[model samples]
Target: MLIFTNMKWQQALKDYKLYLKIERGLSKNSIDNYSRDVDKLIKYLDENKSSNLPINITSEIIQQFIYETSKTINARSQSRLISGLRSFFDYLIFEDYRASNPLELIESPKIGRKLPDTLSEEEIDQLINAVDLSKPQGERNRAILETLYGCGLRVSELINLKLSDLFFDEGFIKVTGKGDKQRFVPIVDITQKYINIYKNEVRNHLKIQPGFEDILFLNRRGKQLTRAMIFTITKQLAEKIGLKKSISPHTFRHSFATHLLENKADLRSIQLMLGHESITTTEIYVHLDKSHLSRALKEFHPRK
Candidate 1:
């Protein structure tokens, strides 16, 4: 017989951190990442309950979370949430906080297959040239577009990016993605050149908002730029170029993934770069890009 002790969700999660470190021999960053995942679970539990507590969590409660998340998040994400719950229960069992892990038999959501869209080298160049370099933000816009294609950042991550995150000296940037997870993504010399040009020639001239002093991108008002602004900018540029494809700041992110996969970049490495918690999410883009096969059809198909 085991006696479950810890009642407070925060306290239990904290103790789980120690177990992941001292017992599991994981690095500090890894332990912290796992903790954040568990925290999200607790938040879900608390918000849905009138009197939330660790003891109140049931299999059905967790299942409800999976269903709700599947509506908004992808299958890859639902899998990560399940993994987080599995870890939480593992910690409970290790600490004797529970007699058994509730997640032992729970199944994960099945993410159906879907391919990602990518731009060809010519298409990418066309998009970059679409920026009106004569304008004040031209250099900045060009660089931002390059960084998006180069770094594969979500709009939120790109907008929330900070000057301090740049590690040009080491050829990488410390990116903070969903759940505040940090990962260092490598930057090539070409991306570095463009970004540095914008930083020196453009971002330096902004009026500079007080609290957002270190933010990388800013509006004319000196405040940080929002994701919507980036979307609007991209949409306008796409129309100006007479392009018919529907795209946004996120298209660049997808393009980044497709380009990398087409070039034969490793799935594990791509997953790391994309800030995904599981490789299953990254694998969706592997054959999904289909650049090689699709181009052949366009080039040789008699219907063309």
Candidate 2:
């Protein structure tokens, strides 16, 4: 095996990041997450005074890193780290930097099927009603929350939504999901009304920046909203409404799919609307729709 330096590893990681961005078309947040796993490994190697280079590092050493990481993070995070490292080493093999991936033999920790938290219809109503509509951004915030629950948008997708994506005439909003993959989600009339109110009454009056002309959601500076801002909005609302269950912008999305499933929406339709690549990902919502499942069992089951 050819010996390499830490600098080589750093360079390889940088190139990998670029490939992820340009070739893979991954979002910045995802790129950051993938890069962070490698960063963690690098940090571990440095702190432990290990001299083994990326090209020559043994699976045993990688295992040690994983072992150390498992001590701090949960199984899910440990699994992500292992997966990330495996992807990085695979990239090295693809680039001819290494003959084989060191992480190929490493196994991920088994994690349980952790379901997401969702809000009841009444809880969602309370949260949305808690928004102070008298403020300048109140309409926009209300619209944002409504769109989140109504459209089942990821926080990133919500922030990146563009005006051109709105197709109210046909009653569907185009959403750019993970990896820049675009999908059209049907919009209800009430959701469209809220969005239109914000766009016409609030968003139109803002001094939009040069490049953000088509961006759907903007802050007071007329620039597009950040993921952090969306989290803050949801967090403040939860606090104001005294919601005990910890929730974020994602909770609204969970509620959206769960509610739909309870209303007899098919798994395939929910998957398409949520931009899930697989039905397996969308099936988790079925677990969240316990009331519907219970009612079905009681109504149809002879034993019940």
Q: For this target, which candidate reaches the highest lDDT against the unseen true structure?
A: 2
Best by TM-score: 2
Over 4 Å off, model 2: 1-4, 47-51, 96-100, 290-304
Q: What is the Å distance of residue 214 in model 2 from its true position?
A: 2.1
lDDT of 1 by residue, 39-75 (tens): 7776666566534456546777777777776788877
Q: On a 0 to 1 TM-score scale, where does candidate 1 land against the true structure?
A: 0.63
Candidate 1, which segments miss by more than 4 Å at Cα? 1-111, 289-304
Error of 2 at 188 (Å): 0.5
lDDT of 1: 0.79
lDDT of 2 by residue, 15-101 (tens): 999999988888898899999999998888878877777777889899888887888898998888989999999888888878988
Cα error, residue 25 of model 2, in Å, equals 2.3
Q: Model 1: how far is 196 from its true place, Å? A: 1.9
Worst-scoring 10-residue span by lDDT in model 1: 1-10
| The 10-residue segment with the lowest total lDDT in model 2 | 1-10
